[model samples]
Target: MDRMMMSDLLKTIFSVLLVLVVIIVSRNFIKILKMAVDGLISTEAILSILGLKIVLASAAFIVPAVFVSVLMVLGRMYRDQEMSALSSAGAGVGRLYIAVFKTIIPVVFAAAWMALYVSPWAASKVERIIFEEKQNIGVRAIAEGKFSEYNKGNLIFYVEKITTDNVMHDVFVQDKRENKVGIVTAEKAEVRTINNDLYIVFINGERVQGNAGEVDFVLETFAEYAMRLDSSTEIQENPITGIDTTKLLQTQDLKELSELHHRLSVPFSIIVLAIMAVPLAQVSPRSGVYGNLAAAFLIYFSFANFEKVSGSWMVNGEIPVWLGFWGVYFLAVLFIVILLVRLYGLAWVILQLKGKLV
Candidate 1:
């Protein structure tokens, strides 16, 4: 009977965690879809990124949300006197932790897998997808009135306004494609596709062309100007966020070290948070289960946010790599100690403290 009851409890907690993950993933999907609709991203890119986004986002929240699920389940049980009944029936509150940790171990490993491997892989895919789209689709990938790099800094474009009919006004473009640089300023422009190719058509523009190394330079006024969108433009650097764990481990650069530690911290944190939640999840019989939910979220978010801050500090060389993640772990351990003391008794805690001191 105890085994069955504990099984059901674990199942309920997992079910709740699943729902929360789905809700989080769905909200992110809607946000990304809106970007697609607004032409900020291509339809093909959106479709390709959707699954990866869900996986990455879901992995991010799964471990943290586990605490909320456990809290709700345990809080409900305690609130309804189910825990009290089990206590009377020869089960200590400590017994509940046995079932809890059993359910969490597998989840902790899974979260670790995602944090260290799957999420980064997905991020790399998103970066690759966006890069490919920009290469194939050209300036159409950029919204009007924004500064955008054309071919990885070989060119840059800015527009003051874009009309409903897809016409642009007050255009500024820099051409660094060849040894001779050109700067073009136009009153109006149109991005057009001709013969299965993309071109920017500038009207009433002044073109300034020169090589600084030579004395020869030319400035010309044009009724119309056009430049082809080239595909050879490469992005400058791939970010540490998308790099593989093995590669990150091999590198000792500040940013990569920070990223590697951040990834490692995610899985380790599941154990920390799960421990904190076990005792904190206890609720009074007459009090609502959700009474502790807000506080739990607050604590969890504070911890998670601080992790990002520490990582930033690590990247900036404000702190050592060991300090970056270990400080957060210390805080978690401190929190768990406090929670355990509260769950047991102040008297027992003081006695234990004195014993340690002695």
Candidate 2:
């Protein structure tokens, strides 16, 4: 690659990385700030979590952001006639691709590593830390007169009042276990931990239980009762994002297969965006560099959201695994090739020659 092209690519990549860090950090700071405001995390913990949040957030947006940044940077060069200088010197889009790809290769590698490994590790670590913190928090500040959900809404708790001494009054809990539903009401309750297990001890309470789909319900009254909470509510587990790729391949479960494909696609998307950005970066002579911003964003988000929807369908067996996540990516690649052939000078000539030959 020419020095000028390489230098340009490096400069643009550096600029893109800076913009990504700023935009992603600012956006996710709002979310982490809310956690601190709600007293779920301290200011110190928020600071710690900020780095992890950035990793997770960056993994999600990096592909699309790279596309837009590349478009703007390369588009600006073309707009300012810098690219024309190179073109007149006998350089083509292919040489431009060479220089850009040199820069993109390392970025794609880092992105793949983050998407496949670091992002999940960061997310999982944060989840475990938060889980432990909340567990230690231990119903200490149960909201009065408001229903609190636990274990993905499988368990619910409500307290009419909480005393200064940590005693709870008028406790109501609903437990939804597979095939069974239980509702318990008590005059008072308190949290107890035994050997790392949490329990809610109720006094003067009645319990009602029923099958999920049956009319028969059972009720019993007790002077005192204790119920253990086995739910840890881990945020990410067993999913392909958390599971090692090798381990994911050992299973044939549709959900897991779908997840594996989805996670695999995450890294693959970096390459896709890099390829797509080249031809898509070309702004018409009549339009400014920002003219294609809307189209670029629309194309990217549509691909991502559609892949998510298609992944869900694959998990549910509505679509076959072979044609799931890869299908969306294949379509993206096909679209990019079409655009390149139509817009990139030599590619267009080659396509026309092939058509004439046929």
Cα RMSD to the true fold for all candidates: 9.6, 10.2
Number of clashes recorded per candidate? 0, 0
**Model 2 regions lying over 4 Å from their true place:** 138-240, 344-358
Q: Native-vs-model 1 lDDT?
A: 0.80
lDDT of 2 by residue, 233-254 (tens): 5543433456665666799888
lDDT of 2 at 222: 95
Clashing pairs in 2: none
The TM-score obtained by model 1 is 0.69
Off by over 4 Å in 1: 1-27, 34-40, 139-229, 346-358
Q: Could you tell me the lDDT of residue 173 within candidate 2?
A: 94
Position 94, candidate 2: lDDT: 72
Candidate 1 residues 3-70, lDDT tens each?
A: 65457656765677678767877887898788777666777677778888778877777766777777
Residue 92 lDDT (model 1): 71
lDDT of each: 0.80, 0.77
